[model samples]
Target: MDIIEQAAKRLEELRRAGVEVAPEPQPSVGETARKVGAGSTAPADAQGVAQSRRVELDMNVLTAHGILTPDSVRSQLGDEMRVIKRPLLHNVSGKGAAPVKDANLIMVTSALPGEGKTFMAANLAISIAMELDHTVLLVDADVARPSLPEVFGFDEERGLLDVLTDPTLDLSQVLLRTNIEKLSVLPAGTPHPRATELLASEAMNHLLADMAQRYHDRIIIFDSPPLLVTTEARALAMHMGQVVLVVKAESTTHAEVRNAIAAIESCPVKMAVLNKTTGHVDGHGYGYGYGYGYGYAAKSSASAART
Candidate 1:
């Protein structure tokens, strides 16, 4: 079946399963062509949303082997990282040799909708977790769109918001183990009308601060929403040690990127991940399994250099 039909069928299945599926926005013919062309040339973080004649890849198939490969995460990231943002891997892996800090938080945000911020967050978390000896926690902070539960197959009754709202709730109670050995996920709890308020609460801060201490050796990645859409992302950005912005080529105006950066300029290192990227962006394939060296690289490279 065609892309539209497949998407429709998936939505139908979701509805049959009692999950509410939002209506898929239809793009104009001109807009459709533009997205396809843009997907081909977009930067690393932005290129994953392609107009392919295929259904969403089954996460079950990927996990059937009992291990999550770098290629599996890379493929989920789509073509954008392949082209424009590939250099980011080097930048993230090449930051100066600095003293390593504990699980400093990283919040992934975008300027506007459809920039693929959550998609990048999920893949990046998995990629980071794959590094030998490293553990990673991927938090779905975007309660508005809540993709983690779907991506990792977790129930919505238990998660971050629930724990944050209930003073008696323990963080460990909400943490769910995934198929990946070192990766754990905290899905966005059932949608709440007061999501922003919940995210901004002191309880949330205490939860994260405590989580940082408990998972000191692991990386905590918050997959937040678009800054332009709500203040939630900006609020979360303040707590993070680093904010990685995913900017889509062509689709994202330069002004949008600058404004998002300017809003959170206080962040020590706000790395840009250009998605829907073109291959020439980074100037190399650096494809999966170039060497064990890639696996050994630590995020201390992402720490603020003395420079």
Candidate 2:
């Protein structure tokens, strides 16, 4: 069959299985901002401009519209989660993207919980998978609080935790495919006796190394726990080639952001993504110009939730 015919057949199969595989994400506040900026004729430095653009996603759109979450679990994650995707790609490329076969590791982290790190990771993975021809791997490295499986509505039958504890499990068995084409997932796996130890183990290192080798054109993103909550985030950060710090507006303290930045200094951090923030909040009404039409955000908040 031709490529179009094959794609149509695949879509039909997925639909028959009740898999929602629409190519577009809910319209994001950032999308409009991007469109507005795209028309500019100014020749700005790519790196400088990329750093200023925060990675943003609409979590409310996902939750209200029933879009998938990081853990694959469907829920009303009230706050909006937004993140920049290009900065992430640039960050990965800087870490020696030679050979195009070594899928660089990206750790999405936050200073505190509820700052939308997992949300950012999941959506960013989805965005990358959709935008790039390369395959994407979203790894739930946050074993202490595994959310990747629930976000995508998949169960952690065998994942990082399982693979680390038992070297016998085939990596293919744990690498689950998602509704999004070219997006595979490695869940945190079933909670083990020593989750932290497993993550820090040599076997875990080997496992990640092997996966990178196998999926050369792919990007692997890790949804890790909050840096302040546990040492796991810091430990895993060392292994990653790039770090995308998700900082919540108002909620994330300045000190916390600084500390988080300091911790990630070892790795070449891609620019940080400010998330779940509004320009103004008054009596349950939020007004924020995410450089996108604020009106669109309200409409999308309702429409994208069920999508």
Candidate 3:
């Protein structure tokens, strides 16, 4: 089964098992103010320009979903993400030998639908947002089938595309600031028939450049579409400094991964994560693997796979 099929199957299991999905969370006025820089005593060297809009996130919602928490250093998933985010963080701080242009922009994608690409993207964003020195903008660039709103339980239609299609739309207006001080979201906006063209346009290029360079301490992460399924993924990949390809264990074939990587070969840095692995000893649930690799010949083996 592809990622989407597997996800559907899991949802079915959850339904049969009577798992109670929580209702959408409601953030209080004070909570919203705190997340968007209001009611805060913290000193600011903040973004030079003043921002007028802020969208607060509910921590209860996030934690219930198994995402990183403020004290995420203790969870198993947190441990995994901390290790996964190390190199990305280094590249973000200009600590890499071959610093990539727009290195702060990271793309999370998969060879096909049904791999855990979106899961990887969301977790990575939450993980990086935990950093004291970094703020994260997780953009839902999967224009064809945006899932972030569902993932975060956010009910909104205005986001990234709204800004791109209309010059008058203020980015801050569309940007959603969460209570997680360091994390924000730019939704895919209303879907467009010309998503690929829009992504490939000069306006999109300028928007990415502005996001990357505007805030020196911010990292932009895109939850892009599956590479083989959409031209939009490649278009977004062209603008990324790093690409994390999510390869599902036992499901994604070697040839499929090669082709997906080939699709975004222009990216200076690339990493492959082996998702949904059942390899763990001593009754531990899942043991995620990590790697720093380059080129097509890096590794085609299963034993060393990590995601």
**Model 1: per-residue lDDT, tens digit, 55-174?**
233456434312234555444233333332233333344452342233157788889976666656776776676667567778889988886555444456567776655443456656
Assess the local accuracy of residue 78 in candidate 3 as a C-alpha lDDT between 0 and 100.
68
The C-alpha lDDT values of all candidates are 0.60, 0.60, 0.71
Alpha carbon lDDT of residue 210, candidate 2? 69
- After superposition, candidate 2 runs with Cα above 4 Å error: 1-83, 91-103, 280-307
How well does candidate 3 match the true structure, expressed as C-alpha RMSD?
Answer: 14.2
Tens digits of per-residue lDDT, candidate 2, 1-307, equal 4434534554554444344444534458898789767765433344222111111234554454344445444322223332255545654565343322232687888888876677667767776776545578888888878876555544455677765554334466566665566677777888776677667655566566766676656798899888887877777777776777877776788899888877776775445766655543224453332212122232122101100
- Runs in model 3 lying further than 4 Å from the true structure: 1-52, 281-307
Worst 10 contiguous positions by lDDT, candidate 3: 293-302
Off by over 4 Å in 1: 1-58, 61-103, 284-307
lDDT of 3: 0.71
**Tens-digit per-residue lDDT, 1-307, candidate 3:** 4434533443443344344333335689988877877544433335432353466666666555555567654755666676678877778778976676888899999989877677678889988887888889899988878877766768866887766665545577677777777888988997766666676666677678778776556898999989998887887788888988888778889899889989999888888877666665225454533322111111122211222
Cα RMSD (angstroms) for every candidate in the order listed:
18.3, 18.6, 14.2
